[model samples]
Target: MHILMVSHFFESHLGGIERVAGHLSRQMIAQGAELTWAASAQDRAPVDIPALALPCVNPTEKLTGLPMPIPGPGGMAALWRAVGRCDAVVVHDALYVTSILALVMARMRGRRVVLIQHIAGIPFASSVMRWVMGLANAMVTRPMLWAADRLVFISDTVRRDLIGDPARRDYALLFNGVDGEVFTHIGPAAQRLPEGKRRVLFVGRFVEKKGLSILRAAAAMRPDISFLLAGAGPIRPASWGLANVHDLGPQKPAQLAALYRSADCLLLPSVGEGYPLVIQEAMACGLPVICGAPTDRADPEAGQFLRGVPVDLSDPDGSAARVVAMLDAPCLTLPERAQMAAWAAGRYSWAAMARAIMGLMAG
Candidate 1:
């Protein structure tokens, strides 16, 4: 099968959906599918597979910290050609300009399109921005979702909230998978915690939606606890100048797995998310996770091991207080940690996720 996969950025972009696409692309290729990844030229695609780099200008991300890349005229034309040759088209999400365009072009060309919706709505700090996102979802996202031949929702919260009735809608709920080989429980559980302070790790882009400011507030309240931050973005945690805050910048998978094994807990305070790959990775490595209330409940099975706290963008201190309370709660036992790791390894499988997506594409 000649499959054309489209995303806003390549896996190197350091976001959830991009990473999922990268894994799916490799798995599909391993299963003997001819996959062509198409995305913004801002990041390079995997050299092993064929890729079409669409030249784009990312003014939205630069100005607002929302990565919305608009492909140039020439790049759009190139995508048009790729869609014509491909047997099927797979789009990551419907919100992106690239995704919306791909949906329209694929439909016009009579190619099968499968949309994998990753998130429902991001609760932005700015009221105007929130309103704008809502309008975009109603005007653009919903329409593309209905237009696609098959729809796959990664989060139960998103599917339930967006579609309302799964009994009537034709959609599949597939949770993302984690690489057990890379992320597994390592070393003694006691050795995981440092002697002096408890370490809380945050992995993902430093965006307002990711709740870095709230984390910073939490860090300020707890001077003794060390906050190890992984990933970089417009919002610089290093600039916050907190004594306990250590910004490690973006990390590779192996390095991230090491962090997961070393840290006392994993923290992701963002809202409007699907079940994040980081949460799965942390669990696979036997690290406990604390995230926003909505996402902690993204998946019921995963939620059992996660701790969720209400996030109020307006009241950073209050949000931070709740995070601190979760942190202060008793740590999971060594056996409990092992149990968490085993649960993740047994539940999430990259091969399974790839097979399901390919089946949908085939239909």
Candidate 2:
């Protein structure tokens, strides 16, 4: 089936939703589906897929803060045109204005519109920002939901949140998959730590929602373990004086692979998430994960690689203790690690994610 995937950001800016969209688009193309992607010109060109760039709706007005547009003219028209040419349109991240426009236009065209929601909660912002966001969502979300032929959520928790009521059954859960081969090549986890120090890796944006402060406090509490923070954002510099932590900035896929290879475990204390692609990536590298429990029901298949640890954002000391426990636990053996890696390879493959999305499209 011909599909048009609309996202506000793409490969140039590496985020979870952007990565999911890029991965799905590539897989769909491999399966002989015609795919066209639309995103803001502010984003860099996507990997392997040709994309139509729309003008940045809300241009990044500040250098130090987040770069996002408010919604512009050309972007709306490009979205409409992209969706018009395809048999169906999949809108990733419903909160984005571009996705909302595509949803409305696709419905108007009588084409199937699938909304992919990545997060379960809205950002906790200032009263004014919260009000604006709530108003914007109210204006756009209902129409998008009505227009969508199907709603695909990355996790069961996200699906439930989007539907709001247990009685409402309008969405399906599609778990994010990983590229097994890329991670399988990470070789065995290094037996010896560099300089005999336990290396803990944190991958994701430096945002409050990611529980960066919790991670910082945790690192400070455990001066023995060395920490490597990957990815760029507002929170990176804020983590400044902790001698044990090293902010490697953002790394390319290869660099990330190396980081995973050298690390003992992946540390993610996110306050919100649908499904973190980094978890799969870490598992692919044969590294066990210690993450905040997803509010969604656990996936039975994923139990082996993940240890659901409790994180109290308000209590940094308690959160640090959790991280310390993870760090002190017995490391997974080579054989055990291999099993986790294989599980990730088998369960989270791009092909599998694409097939799940295709099933939604067909339904």
Per-residue lDDT tens digits of candidate 2, residues 1-363? 889988878766767788888989999999989898888777687757978888875543244233355457766776777777899888887767778778778878899878887775544324554565567567766556656788777776666555765727577767777766566635544344456778889998877667687788888888888888888776654347987888888787767877788788889887557778898788888887888776314455677567777666567678778868877888788898888887777777788878878878877
Segments in model 1 whose C-alpha atoms lie over 4 Å from true places: 165-168, 187-195
lDDT of 1: 0.89
The model with the greatest TM-score is 1
lDDT of 1 at 356: 95
| Residues 2-30, model 1: lDDT tens digits | 99999999988898899999999988999
Query: Where is model 2 poorest over a 10-residue stretch in terms of lDDT?
Result: 58-67
State the weakest 10-residue window (summed lDDT) of model 1: 187-196
lDDT of the structure predicted as candidate 2: 0.74
Clashing pairs in 1: 231-249
- Listed in order, each prediction's TM-score against the native is 0.97, 0.87
Would you list the C-alpha lDDT of every candidate in the order shown? 0.89, 0.74
Q: Please state every model's RMSD to the true fold in angstroms.
A: 1.7, 3.1
